[model samples]
Target: MVKQANKPTVWFNADEADILEAFSSAVTSTQLIQLIGPSSQLVIIDEAQQIPDIGKKLKLIYDNRPDIQVIATGSSAFDLQSQTAEPLTGRKKTFQLYPISFGETVKDTSRLEAKRLLDSRLIYGLYPEVLNNPGQEKEILIEIAQSYLYKDVLQLDSIRKPSHIEKLLKALAFQVGSEVSYHELAQTIGNIDTATVEKYLDLLEKAFVIFKLPAFNRNLRNEIKKGKKYYFYDNGIRNVLINNFTFPEMRQDKGALWENFLISERLKFNAYQSRFVNTYFWRTHDKAEIDYLEETDGILYAYEFKWKDQKVRFPASFLQSYPEHQTAVVTRQNFEGFLGA
Candidate 1:
């Protein structure tokens, strides 16, 4: 978008001293405008969450300067979202960029090439830098996990025990694709309470480290909705948290890993394509389950992820209940179509 725009653009890092100076009380809007000059038509601030009053600053720029379009980017939703919520309400649009999706990653590749890259992608994830670096995926993923992943969460004043957060994430890594219990999480991470466990999980979610898939429940007495399943935004980060990068054949949790990868990719695909849908996992007291479910436009879509191609049918209870719903098993052979790749 930036490259295609015909107007001159000015870029600013919110952490820079001069950018902060521009937002100071002493500097009038006119002075800041003069500093930017007339030709600068767009202003982009990266890591906008670093500035405490970024939303106010952006609101000022938006209200005062009609000619300059502003775009702000932040790594942590908790920081930038809260700071911008009231100030930019109805005045700004928001976009979230997740790790590169399968469609974007393989846009120009052949089916053979995509197949060749599948194993690596499943293990190391689709981070842009990881894709570009190729053979150094482990190093890149570890660096991202240790250095950049939790940086924003750690900076938040509410999170006092950073070590506990790390332990909490490691426990979550082991429980992907399964319902998580806050009480069990608290027990796993010593010195933390159930409330703290919930708070930390919320913090991790807002920071974009993880996302929860709530249970799909109708009014049926047997439907499950008491717990939620959490999945990482990136498979590589999850693997790094667990400190395991073994090949699929050598790993006992390959099925769970495949499920996580597919769900995460589908999420990115949906978000990027602006496909509005409510997502969840469906299970009943009798253990009849579907791995992923989507409700969109008054229609129910149920999907099961399989590492190998296999014929499967919808749960009998679900079919008896909602026979009009669509059901499909997404496997290695046809996942590209499922993810819109």
Candidate 2:
């Protein structure tokens, strides 16, 4: 979009001291115009959440300079949304950029090539840097996981103990593809309360580090309603958190990694295609479970992700209760269609 925009486009990265100073001092639309130059037809502010009164400033620009287009990008969503929500309510369009998806890789390369790298992707993940740097995925993932992943979460005033957040993240990483309990997480992290666990988890989610999938329950009394499973936005980050980059064949948690990879990629697929769907994992107290569920247009779809070609049978109880549904098992051999590739 930036490349296709008009000439004389001004790009301001808020991370730079001078750029931050200029934006911080631009109190009015006229001042902002002068700072950005009146000749500029498009303006882009990266790390926009770092600038104070950004929403109002953007609003001023929109109201005064109808000729210029302004684009704001920020990594810390909680900060960005809170600052921009009210002032830019009717003035802005928001977009989320996720890690590289299977569909994108297939588009860039071919479905055959993407399929060939499935095992590597499962272990190293689909992060752009990791994907681009084939041999140095472990090192890059380690750097991202350690230095960049928790940058936003650590900056929040609500976060008092940073160590607890790391421990909690490690715990969640280990338990991927399984139900998570805040109380159990609290105990696992030690010295943390369930409320703090929940709060940190919420912050992590806002930071796009992890996402929660709640139990799918409707008419069935035996369905586990309050249960939730948390999956990382990127499998690389999850694997780095646990310090595991072992090949899928050598890893004991290959099943978990496969589930995490498919679900995360599916999430990116659904979002990119603008599919409005509710996602969940279904499990009953009696141990009948479906790996993943998507409800769209009043129709339920159940999916089971497997690393190997294996017989998968959707619990009879689930089939009987939700008769109007579709089911499929996604394996490496047949996952391209499932991921919209």
Candidate 3:
């Protein structure tokens, strides 16, 4: 974006306590402008969430200086959004960036290479570092999952029992590709209430650890609408939680893993392309279900995931109710289009 704007760039690390304190302690926007000096076209702030009152500060700079554009980035949105929500309401545009997507990777590689890398990607995930450092993918993923992913959330005041956060993550990890019960999760975690479980899950999502897909329903009596299914933003992190990084062929939950991989990559594609859509999973009391459902522009697109060749039939009741929608089976044979690859 800096290069495209044809502007000289100035960068700052908000994570540095000295710089953040000094900059934020400035009395006014005029002082900030003087501190930044002249001829600065673009100002990029890394880990912007760490600095208190950063949103207001950025807004001050933005309102005062029309020539300079500001870009703020952080690992977690929980802090950043809370601080920026009201202050930068009209001044900012927020984006959620995940690991590399299939749509992006395919652009640089041939179809055959993409196919060959599918298993490795599904196992180790699409993190840029993991994708680039072939020999150290496991180490990198473990370090990220343990040390980097939850750093922002852990620092928040709302988190009292930090250890429970990891426990909740592990429970969610085990239940991937399946509907989650908050009550059941609370029971499993012992001494924690259902509300805390929910809060932790929300924090995890804001920290980019997991995302929930709510059940899709049309108010049908038998339609399951109360629960939600959670998936890790990265399979490598999920694997770290479960402590299993075996080859896909040796894993019994290959289908579930494949589903997680596809859904996450699909999400990344949707986000990067700015395809605004409401996503969900559909199921009925009688066990009829679709793995993924996406609604866009008042049109429903349903997908059932399969790691291998299998006969997948859409629920008859779903077809009868939503005849205007489209349904397709996604599998290894023809998943490229489904993933926008």
Candidate 4:
């Protein structure tokens, strides 16, 4: 039988100075058990990566106390995953929580209102604080970009110079919709090798700041295979990296911003609803391209994102190769359905 919901729950934040001190001393399983009393039905440990040997400690609790449910959360994937991978292999189930999604905003208000705020969403993004505080988006984004964005990556021993990561992020920010080359990035961020650039990119990805879209090239000889494009998990973060918070109408990269917004929101939409799909960008060496592609259950879906309502024609080469596919152009006027709202 499961524990009833009426029982008490215990919460601990390993980042808090007092909690850190207490956890640092509670080394043994017995000591840890004493710290978390038997009366609690649930134990929640936030910033669990800060606790030493967290995985083994969690395993011990699971082994000893069969009644009490435990939840451990960490902001940084690299630290948390590394610490927990070995000890709590089968004992844990992980879930990723992204920034607030378009569907969620619609739930809070009406779909019409969500559409009305589309420009603001594109400029300021949908982070909880940014959404809650209407006019303070710029200051909040600046703080997040400078203070918390690289907090985890900078702490790693492998990252000796922080400037390289900053430069790499700026370069990625500038090339949001375009294919990125490691050699070119290395040349741009002087004194850094291609290997380090790749490493920093990986770290940023693991940290959930950005995601990569690989080229789809299973069919055509002209399709570019060895190409990758990066998009931020949030548009505001990308803008803050390059210090561009211009309104959508005034910006030159409105199309890129729109593409990033659609892709990221679509990511959150698919994730929340458990729609499993493999994603990519389609491009040919000769410059014909489709902005985004998704393959699900062996069916291809191609999408082209436009900031304004416009007719778009997908590449003929791609259509000929993948004949049995769905295609659509997602525009500002009809983007609500694209984001699963």
Candidate 5:
């Protein structure tokens, strides 16, 4: 729930706080006003997607009552928007509260503790239950997918078939941080069009399940026109779906996944920390690719993610073009320095 300045943070702790079930069958403004308590300023409805005509209802509430701040919390807002996008136009503010951010896991936790928890996050994912009791991982994951993931997908026309969606998710889990071809994905899941594939992927994005990063488009459009990369919101979720939750040392692709996950976490950190910046990945036709390209004002920050501590060589062509850009090596040995800097 979004924090309301008028109300105390903890409802139960406050003397004036009164949490009422604002859910109502009120069709008119009079009925809507009657549902909410007179003193109530902040309205928080959990599982808001369950409400019938959610978007229209929200818009009505927001429009009718300017005094009350409506903050509807739902794991799947996609359904609400699908029901009616116009009803809630320019009224509600959408904020994504993911399972748990990478920064959250390591905030107060010791480095050793963080590493210990990473394996569980890698496999079962950072979904509340799996992060809590990792033993019942498979059960929790399947339940989460069936309960929340399926509910929205089933409602969407693009993904009428649940089995195909599951198969697509499983296939994409292995291809984390890699460009996904819609045509190839459709072919793998039997008969489906590329547009359908794109639509299904969009549904996932809308639900905050996965994030797709478009290839950076500069004047060199041919270099980036090929394919866009897809990444799971949580590294743990990605690992779990792929069935590759081996120990860091034993897992060959662990480094790659970790790097990918860290990049996302860092991006999250920047956003949450209120830093103004943009992200990109620069690549040339000759196969020269820079992992991350961040631009703040006219200044550019280029990063290369590698597991090894060995030296990295930036392309001479890139230096000739953007000599002012800052380049750095992020590896096991130097990552701490990068973070500190």
Candidate 6:
């Protein structure tokens, strides 16, 4: 729709200093308001996060333009969120754009083309550019993580030792689909405090690098435990960071990696479809556990992910108590249905 805009559009590449000077100077917003010509009612700030005091300036622009609109776009959410919450408080809607989901990439699983799509997803992990060019995906995501995620972190927080942050993220990449211990991370990363590790994790999550899935509970005894499991936003980045892209099809943990990717993608699917969801990996002290448990609107979907063609059976406890929740095995054949959704 933006490409189809009929009027002439001008993009202003205002830097960090430009925004600071504009905010702390003798000239008020009234002077800046005069410069906005008749055709330029809608001011689109590209990379608005770079500009400090942007929240205040945007509120000023918004109040002045009763007829016009402001569109702010950036790779990270920090810029718009920090400022808008205080000054532009009742205004602004938040939306996120994720990598092309597997459903979007596949039209029908029976088609021969879908196999190729699956292979690409395995190697490239669904970032849009990787979908277009499957070969250079590893390099592209590394560049995004380093150049974009890393650069944005520095601007938001003051960390005297940035090296520890990289190690913390790389540590997270290896521990996907498992509970993360911030204390252990602090101990390993040497000299960095525990709070710093957690702060960096929150920042990484905000930048779309990682997602932590919380434990589930049905108001039962000893449920909803502490230590949430973490998953990287992309499988390719996870594999590359841990130096474990060693032909998973031939590796021992192929089953675990595939299961993690499938569960995470399904969660993303539920969210994008506007369905409210509760998720978990169910386990008991005795070691019997389901790979993924998902509940929505009082209905449940219990899933077990496996690579082999073993016989499936239900747990006596779940069948007796939680029979209302649907149960299924997500194996090679039936897995397509979930991804093709």
lDDT of every model, 2 decimals: 0.84, 0.89, 0.85, 0.88, 0.67, 0.68
Per-residue alpha-carbon lDDT of candidate 1 for residues 240-313, written as tens digits (9 for 90 to 100): 99989887878899988999999998998899888999999999989999999999987899999998899898
Per TM-score, what order, best first?
2, 4, 3, 1, 6, 5
My TM-score estimates for the predictions, one after another, are 0.94, 0.96, 0.95, 0.96, 0.83, 0.84
lDDT of 3 by residue, 1-341 (tens): 13345678778887788878877786589987776656788888888888778888888888999788888888757778888889888888887778888777788787889888898888888889998898998899888876765565687656777778878888988888999999999999888999988888877777778899999999578999786999999998889888898989899999889999989988988887789899999999999889999998778999999988789888889999887799888888999998888
lDDT of 4 by residue, 104-188 (tens): 9899999889888988998889899999998899999998887767666788546788898889999999999999999999999
Where does candidate 4 clash, by residue pair? none
For 1-341, candidate 6 gives per-residue lDDT tens digits of 13325554445444556643554451446754654444565666666665666777767767776655666667657655775678777766666777767676665343457555554565558777766775787788777667765677666666666687778877887676566788988888888888888888888787777777766655445444664777777777777666665655677767757776787678678768886777777655444556788787777788888776677776665656676788888876677677545
- Two-way lDDT contest, 3 vs 5, winner: 3
lDDT: which is higher, 3 or 6? 3
Worst 10 residues of 2 by lDDT: 1-10
- Per-residue lDDT of 63 in model 5: 81
Tens digit of per-residue lDDT, candidate 5, span 1-341? 34566573212111122322334355666666566545667766666666667677767767877877766665556765565467877776666565666456667576567656655555556666777775787777777777766766566565557887887888787777566788889999877888888888887887777777666655454455555777777776666566666766677787667666656666666767677887767777778777777788877788888766778898776766776688987876555444432
**If both were scored by TM-score, which would come out higher, candidate 1 or candidate 5?**
1
Question: Any runs in candidate 4 off by more than 4 Å, and if so which?
Answer: 1-6
Name the candidate, 3 or 4, with the larger TM-score value: 4
Best by lDDT: 2
Sorted by lDDT (best first), the order is 2, 4, 3, 1, 6, 5
Q: Model 4 Cα displacement at 199 (Å)? A: 0.6
Tell how far residue 57 is off in model 3, in angstroms.
0.9
